[model samples]
Target: MKKSDLALGIFLLSAIIFMIIPMPAALLDILLALNISIALIILLNALFSQEALNMSSFPSILLFTTLFRISLNISSTKLILTTGAPGNVVTTFGNFVGGGDLIVGIIVYIVLIIIQFIVINKGSERVAEVTARFTLDAMPGKQMAIDADLNTGAITDVQARERREKIQEESSFFGAMDGATKYVKGDATAGLVITFINFIGGIAIGMFRQGLGFNEALDRYTILTIGDGLVSQIPSLMISLATGILVTKVSKEADMGDILVKQLFSIPKVLYMVGAAMIFLGITTPLNVVVFSAYGLLFIISGRVIANRIEIAGIEEEVNTDESSADEIRRPENVTSLLQVDPIELEFGYGIIPLADTNQGGDLLDRVVMIRRQVALELGCVVPMIRLRDNIQLKPNQYVIKIKGTPVSEGEILFDHYMAMNPGYVEEEITGIPTFEPSFHLPAIWITESQRERAESLGYTVVDPPSIIATHLTEVIRNNLGELLTRQDVQNLINNVQESNSTLISELIPKLLGIGEVQKVLQNLLKEGISIRDLITILETLADFASTTRDTDVLTEYVRQSLKRAISNKYFPDSETTSVVTLDPKIEQEIMGSVKQTEQGTYLTLDPEKTQDIIHSVGEEVSKLENLGKNPIIITSPIVRMYFKKLTSDYYKDLIVISYNEIESDVELQSVGMVTA
Candidate 1:
């Protein structure tokens, strides 16, 4: 076991032993001194701690200390009743501090008991209860604030986790403190009862058992009992004060001492007023004028020093600002500086700056971060950081999304309005400015915020401007993920996969296929809206097939066949049947015949007219399926699936093309339409 753990175990066992076994006066004095030292240590810790969580172990420590003190009280009571002496510590306190008078010692001990029980302990208990309630009640809001910061990239994952853990610790510390205060309250009550019992029982034992006179018994027993009470109560008072300070502490980065010094003397005006009042009192009152005047002079001098410091600080701040401004003006800008471009950039007009500015209460950066996370989960690749800035050249409501310095999508939004799009079945019409939904190019109207409920009631989906832009950005990135996956990105994926499947990575990478080749396969999958999250499975499949072929297209087809279950679940969910369009047997055979193999790779050797006729036929079937409210998934034989997807991807990017072998055996296919040529 650790030395600290062994020491704690031995110490707790000693506390238990002290109650049953009586120790000599010297040992008792040593333990009593240790108790006072421990209480002082706890109090100092509480005073210096900036946050309650910094002393989270205090509740358990409080319980142990209270038990230790109670055991000491029991042992000392026994020693006093039997021998008319508790210990040197108690005897010294009774004689010196209590003035060697029975009446004075009893009065002083009673006052200590009353102060500890009624004042410090009571106040600490109430504060602990209230602080616990507030901490628990505010937990959810604090957690949500952490999440918001995380989503906005204001904090990273590690920082967010730390903040969440701190919040939990604060709540638990207060809750434990709420219960621990009861131990203090009970200890104070026990001390009061123990003192009374010690006095009466000691007097009876001294007179009846030891044959002492009444006056002698009273003097000896009372002095020892009062001394023991003072010894215990003083430490109890210190502990109670510490508990109050801990629960009442406000969480900040600076300790209580620093906070007090900074805030209590922050303003010189209050110090000056107090100093003047003290001087006036010295002049008018019968109090010692010299003492009051001396304090007043000290206060006046301190205030003057503080005021001078504040003035100097202001001057320094202004000088620093001037130097910074001069440095900025003297710095030269070069044309090469403008050559750096963001991988993804969103430019907003000046009027829409509030949508991205955090100081203006805009959550657009947070929304963009969430969009990146969502895209990463859906596409199995991290979206590049989006740089948001204002462009003065654009129209006031306009925005543009750029990829690698080139604008790919543009849209306009009314900052104060909501975009309501008809779900294609709404019977009621809403009046507003007609516009196309930037994400999907669907007909939508920009309506006022007040019209949102009515528009929703009429079967329209309403979204705010930031959400509209975020959605547009998501779609643009999803469509262009192929261009973003460099060989380095593939290496990152391999390194990630290596953590769990080292054997597969070592065997597959740089052996059968290089990173460039793997990048092509990943791009091919991403280009078709397929997720590459299952990298281990993809690499394993490649390990088996890559040795036979260097062709990326052929390899991609093989990988697709291996991911049948994932692909099937994406479109069909939990269903056992899939609705799809199929080609006629003649058309399938004719297309298969046009596929020619060469040294470079495979190619389709079909005539232009034949291909056009086939495209038209397939387009008609797809349209028919769409009109029936079904996704247009085309099922072709395994050999022609890749070629067919390549042929139609430019025109029908949203169409899903799967092969016969790609369908899981448990799924039944129901033909909804057919393409014939």
Candidate 2:
């Protein structure tokens, strides 16, 4: 064990032995001195600590010290009753206080016990109880404040976590103090009882065994008992005061002395008024004018000094501001800095600042964090950090979501209103400003807070302003997920997966396929809104077929077929039948004949008129499916699925194109409509 740990163990063991073992007068004197020193040290430490959490171990220390003092009381009582002498420390205190009168000494000791037990100990216990209760009650609000700061970017994750831990420790410390105060009260009561026992027992033993008279025995034993009580109560009183100071302390970054000086003298006018009142009292009463006048003069001088310091600080701040302004004007700008761009940026108008500002109850930053986590779960890749900025040139309530420096989606919101969306069939009409929801372009209205219950009762989905923006941003990022998965992001994924499945990563990366090639395949899957979360399966599939052909599109199709069960569960979860629109047999054959292979990749070589007719036919089929309230999914032969998806993407971007091979055989496929040319 380390030297410090060994020493602490020895010290605690010695305290326990002090009660059982009898010590000489010299050793007893030294132990008494040590006890006083420890009490003083504890009090000083409490006074100097910056915050209550800094002294988190104080409760344990208080318990040990209380036990040690009680043990010393027992050892001294043994010596006083048996030998009529405790130690030099006790003798000196008794002679100093009694002055040949044991009655005075006993009364003084009783008063000290009363103060320690009734005043400091009891008051401290009450304060600690209330502080602990309030601390526990306020814990939830404090935790929420930390989360708000974290979401607003005012503090990082590590800082917020540390603050939360500190709050917890503080609450626990106060609770411990509440229980530790009982030890102090008990110790004081024990000291009083022990002193009475020593006085009565010592008198009887001295008179009967030592053959002393009654007066002589009473004088000798009473003085020794009072001395022991005084010696013990002094240290006990200091410890009780320390406990009170610690529990009553407020949480701040400044020590008690600094806080007192700063707050007590914060206003100099109060001091000046008090000084004026003192001078008037001295003149009216028959008191010594010089004494009161001297104090008045001192207060006046101190107030002036404080006032001058405040004025100087104000002047210095103003001077610094002016200097900073001049420095900014003289600084040169770099034009190249303007070329830098964020991966994703949200620009909002000035009036919408409250949506991102924590001070105004804005949770936009928190929403953005949740969106990032949600996207990572659904898409299997982390999105880039979103940069939020305010643009004065835009409309007050408008916000724009940008990807790669280009504005992709922009919408407006009313801060004080909620967007109530009609799910296409609502019986009741709630009056409000008519608008379309930005996320899905659904019919919605900006309704007041009072109308929220009515809108919901009418079967309309009600959303707040922050949720609207967060939902819109989520869709925009999901659509651009392919572009967001950079080469570095792919490498990161491989490294993370290698930690658990190292052999799989080693066989696939830089051997069967390069990171860039893997990135392309992942992008292809993402473009079709497929989650690459099952990356081990994707990488294993690539390792199997990548040696034969380097075509990313063809490799992606193979991965999809391998994930057929996952795909089936996503689209037709808990359903036995998958409804889809199919191309006519003749149309599928005609498109398959037009497919041409080249060195770069495969290409569709259909005539412009034929492609136009195919698109018109697909559109008609999609409309018919929508009218039936069915999701539009196109199923075709495995050979022409990619080509057909490309053709319909421009006009029907929301349509899901699947191949017959991608569906599991257990899932029944029902043809809702057919596209004919």
Candidate 3:
């Protein structure tokens, strides 16, 4: 049988024995039995409330003991005193003159007190121990409850109470003590103290006699050495037992306070407050009172000492089963395969330190669990069981993209390593056109007039720079000066040439200018930070003497000659180089060439094959460009009628379209309507 069952049986048997005891002995035994029975009732209630105990006989046992003890204590004590049994027995047992009989009586009383103290203390410790075990078992559920409550911020006292109620409903009687286990383990000494106090109270209640005033009864009770002070303690002892039971059930544990209180409440009943009143009115037991009160006093001191030490119980090292599964899975003989550090900028400083001689892994498992939960919440998916040494697979659908092999700064090699690990991810790079190619290798012709003055005012200057002249042959070649060049194709050519040559600008600058235009050109070239020495070559070429320099309407034929000669001589020192060069010659050419002719009266010419294709292509392009502009137009060279084969239909088109000031009037080119073709 369990300890509690044994205790219950013992108490019940004692109650029965006291009920049937020879009358003189029955009185004191019965009172002691009642207190014992009450303690047993509390123990049985704690275990049975959850229906864990087959205590169908408990009610019968309890009622029987209560009746038997009450009837016997009153009847037996009456019979004993009336027959002078105690006095006769004491005298016969020892020599009172030398104090032998008194000493023997005292020893018997002391033994009784020791027995009572042990019973209460043992019961109290048992309750605490059982309750603590139940508490440890419920830890996971309790942890979940607290976490859920904290997360929702709705953890009010009412919610806590409700939680307790729910636990109580779901749990066995002992389970109610789960919450109290921690407190109880730390209060074992207090449980002892309470037990001692209750025993002392029992003795206090047992020592009283009946029929006297309060002080008079007390004096008589004081003379009763065996049960002195016991009668007065009955009520307190009962209260303590009841309180300890409720507390143990609800808290799932007991401490020294419980033992002390139980002792207080379970004292011999005749010295209870009612008994005290009875003592004043002439009814209590002197011998019972003396023994109970003396024991109560002894218990108080011992109970305090026990309370102080109970909290110090050694926690044995048991493998926490919850942690065992994780421990068993730790990758032994493993090396760190991947490490992901957040805010890679902190890799050099605030990153995780090496764990040797450190606390880094103290809560590593919890951290991993928390992170896994967070990741699940974020991704709206369940993650696989993560093993400490298992590699994180980078499947296409896996959201975590990469991991690092080593710590690194932001934008540093480790970051690059991280970026490289993901096969399909794109890295950032630069794509805009570089400036050197367009200026030096393309037929970057600038209009001298449109109205050339208007073109100049918008910061569009006719390029006459030395670098322009020197690169002229190369530009013509790049622009398809001798080959078919689509605009896009021309752009690609220039880009290719620039990419191929590191100093393309230096090679092209000195070839394109003449001395006659040098001063005006030099100013422009110098504005871009070019040297006068390079300009001197172009000036010297113009000195070969080709033209009059002062003409206003156009450059003297000689100036064009000097400039062209200089450009050709520099880019193509071998005559075969000049023969190989070409300028813009594609569909856009035919269109611009046609526009140059018919839009104005300028002298222009086109091959028959080119002219017709030009007209067709220009017509197609004009239709598209029309939609692109607010009041769209086909703009062409200003001085040549053949320059403009077409014009837009709107008057405001002139205001919006780009032009040159060399045109005498806006009428230099005019539009009829949408082209019929």
Per-model CA lDDT versus the true structure:
0.89, 0.88, 0.36
lDDT of 1 by residue, 1-677 (tens): 99999989988999999999988889999999999999999999999988888889999999999999999999999899888767799999888879999989888888888888888988999999999999899999999999999999999999999999989898888999999999999989999899999989988998899999999999998898888989998999999999999988885789998899989887898889988999999989998899999888888889999999999999999999999988876777554567898889999899889989899988999999998899889878988788999999999989999989999999999989999998898979989999999988999999997899999999999999988988998899999888888888899989999998999988988888999999999999999888999888889999999999979998998999899988877777766576789977777787789998898788888888988888898899899878877888998988888888877877788989888887888788889878776
Tell me the deviation in Å of residue 494 in model 3: 51
lDDT of 3: 0.36
Mark the regions of model 1 whose C-alpha exceeds 4 Å error after superposition: 1-334, 574-577, 589-602
Top candidate, metric lDDT: 1
In order of listing, the candidates' clash counts read 0, 0, 124
- The candidate scoring highest on TM-score is 2
TM-score of each: 0.53, 0.54, 0.23
Please provide, for model 3 over 536-618, each residue's C-alpha lDDT reduced to its tens digit, 9 standing for 90 to 100. 34334343432433221122222323344332333234423111101123433554554432232334455666555545544
Query: After superposition on all CA atoms, what RMSD does each candidate show versus the true structure?
Result: 12.6, 11.7, 29.3
Residue pairs with backbone overlap in model 1: none
Residue 345, candidate 2: Cα error in Å is 1.3
